[model samples]
Target: MKLQQLSLFLENRPGRLGAPLEAIAAEGINILTLSLADTAQFGILRLIVREWDKAKQVLEDAGWVVNLTEVVAVDLLDRPGGLAEALKILEAANLNIEYMYAFSLRRGDKAILIFRFEDPDRAIQVLLDNGLHVVDGDELMSFVP
Candidate 1:
């Protein structure tokens, strides 16, 4: 299971983040989740939205460069050592994690985590083989609670 994420490069300055967000908001696109990481010069804004294509168009039309990247959404127990167990499995499979972010919604003691792996296909297979649940895009976006 995989999801498409929109990434935008933003300059490290005040109000730079508001422009693209306002544009997306103007189009009535709701962001499911987002992660913002910054360095000295620039920041990378990663967003997961139900209307990804529309959101990308809105940003691009606003004179911003948008990149689409594939990431995996995983269903993990909201308990101690939950993440560690997953990491251990991945480590055993020799998979590399590029980055990760989490959605705040807790669905019945389950937490959804977004992971960027070097090889997503293999990682998904490995996780499934270990009896882990990998969430599909539709399932992730359709979660009510």
Candidate 2:
């Protein structure tokens, strides 16, 4: 399964990040997980939210350049080495994970990892073939606050 992720540019300065976040919040969208990587001039914000289109609309309307992409959400045990185990499976399948971030529901002993792969659909197929539980957008929104 795959979920849509939103990526946008944020100037590397205080308060630049707050504008987009505030836009999403004003629309009542919940950010499930996010990762920010910065360079000298700007930063890239990768976010998975409860509602993708609405979130993107808000950011773009507010003058932020927003892009929508596909990402895989894999289910993993919430324990030591759990991630390593999942990586091992992808490794054996010759899948490369470009990047990943994680989040957990309020009451589950499980972690949900959002992955960016060279081939998103293929990665999901490989994870499924290897007995890994690949989660979908609706499933992820199940625990939204």
Candidate 3:
């Protein structure tokens, strides 16, 4: 299964990051998970949200450059080497992960990892074939605050 992720290009300066976040908050949108990677001049803020379309709209209307990316959410055990085990499976299948971020729920002994892969559909198949649970879009939204 694949989910849509929001990527925002923000300048790497004080107060620049909060503007987009505040815009989304004003509309009552919930951020599921996010990752920020920066360079000298700007940063890429990758976010997972349930209401992606609305979030994108608000950010863009506020003058932020936003992009939609297809990403996969995979469920893994919340234990040591759980990620390593999944990585080994992808390695055997020759699937490359471009980037990933993870979050663990307080109620379950499981972790949800958002992954951007070179081939998302193929990666999902490989993960399923290897007995890994691939989180679907609806299931992911259920975890949103």
Candidate 4:
């Protein structure tokens, strides 16, 4: 399936990153994986957190602008060449990867990689056809260490 990701535009200053996390924490939400991209003046914080609705609400309530995007979460091997193999599959299908980040638990062996693609539906089908496990948003929410 797909994962719900929160993207927040923030100022490139001290403690800017902590503000969103603090707001999310107030709502008792847990962050699963995150990616941050910044420019000279501003930054974008992309996060995969538990309780998507509440996390979004909390951030908005705290006067932060946020957007929701659907991304694919695939199970990844915790070894070398694992990611490359998956990328090859997508490449073979002409799928373009916009961005990606890794997710791993402290006590778990398996890892998850969050991917944003130009054509998510087709990418999902390609990954599934290649025998890769796509994680659902709900399943990721209940994931524990």
Candidate 5:
């Protein structure tokens, strides 16, 4: 199970982030979840949109350095230790998590976790065997914000 995450290289300048947002908005693609990892000069804006392929194309045509990455999406209980329990499973399976971010849907009992792991296939199987629910890009996008 995987979702397409758009990673755009953003300069630390005014309106740099706005362009991408506007592009996606213009195409009627709703952003489900987003996170920004920044430094002094630039940052990476990771976005999960309702339409992955369209969003990617829109961003690229607009001259943005956008890339599509397959990330794991897990449904976790909205409670304490829910994340810990999932991490424990990944850790025990020797999966290295490169990055992760999560968000709660407007009407749901579970939170969606987006993860980039060292070994995606193996990690997916491990999570599945361990009883964790894994969702794909289409399924995950269906829960639009």
Candidate 6:
């Protein structure tokens, strides 16, 4: 299972972030999850939305640098060591996690962790074999907050 994450390159200016959000809103795309990783001069806005393709086109049409990446969204318990348990499974498989972010899913008891790994397919298979539930783009988008 994989979700399409939109990576939008934004300059470190006041309205830089607003433009992308505005574009998404204008396109009527519902953002399920978002995180902004910033640097001194720029930032990368990663987003999971209701309509991946439409959101991407809307951003590109507005002249923003956008890219789509497949990220694995694993169901985790919303408590201590929940993430550790998941990582342990990945570590056992020798899969390296490049980056990851967490958010509460529509189902309150579970958390959604989006991970970018060295090998996504391998990671997915490993998690699946271990009985870790992975959600796809559509399912992830349906998650609240």
Best of the candidates, lDDT: 1
Cand. 5 TM to true fold: 0.91
Each candidate: what lDDT? 0.92, 0.85, 0.89, 0.86, 0.86, 0.85
User: How many residue pairs of model 6 clash at the backbone?
Assistant: 0
Residue pairs of candidate 2 with colliding backbone atoms:
none
Every model's TM-score: 0.97, 0.92, 0.95, 0.91, 0.91, 0.92
Per-residue lDDT, model 5, residue 127, is 94
Off by over 4 Å in 4: 106-108
Kindly list the per-residue Cα lDDT of model 5 for residues 10-118, writing each as its tens digit: 9988888898999889998888889888899999999987778899999999999888887898888889999999999999989999999875463377887889987
Give the lDDT ranking, best first.
1, 3, 4, 5, 2, 6
Compared with the true structure, the alpha-carbon lDDT of candidate 2 equals 0.85
* Cα RMSD of predicted structure 2: 1.5
> Which 10 residues in a row give candidate 3 its minimum summed lDDT?
101-110
The model with the greater lDDT, 1 or 6, is 1
Worst 10 residues of 1 by lDDT: 136-145
State the lDDT at 5 in candidate 2.
90
- Tens-place lDDT digits, model 1, residues 1-145: 8899999999999999999999999988988889998999999999999989999998998899999999998989989999999999999999999999997577788998999999999999999999999999888877843
Instruction: Give one digit per residue, the lDDT tens place, for model 6 in 30-128.
Output: 888888899999999999887889999999999988999988888887789988998898998899998898854546778778899879999999999
42-82 per-residue lDDT for model 4 (tens digits): 99999887778889989999999999998999987778998
Write the residue-wise lDDT of candidate 3 on 53-105 in tens digits: 99999999998899999999888988999999999999999999899988435
Query: Worst ten-residue run, lDDT, model 6?
Result: 136-145
Q: In candidate 4, which residue pairs clash?
A: none
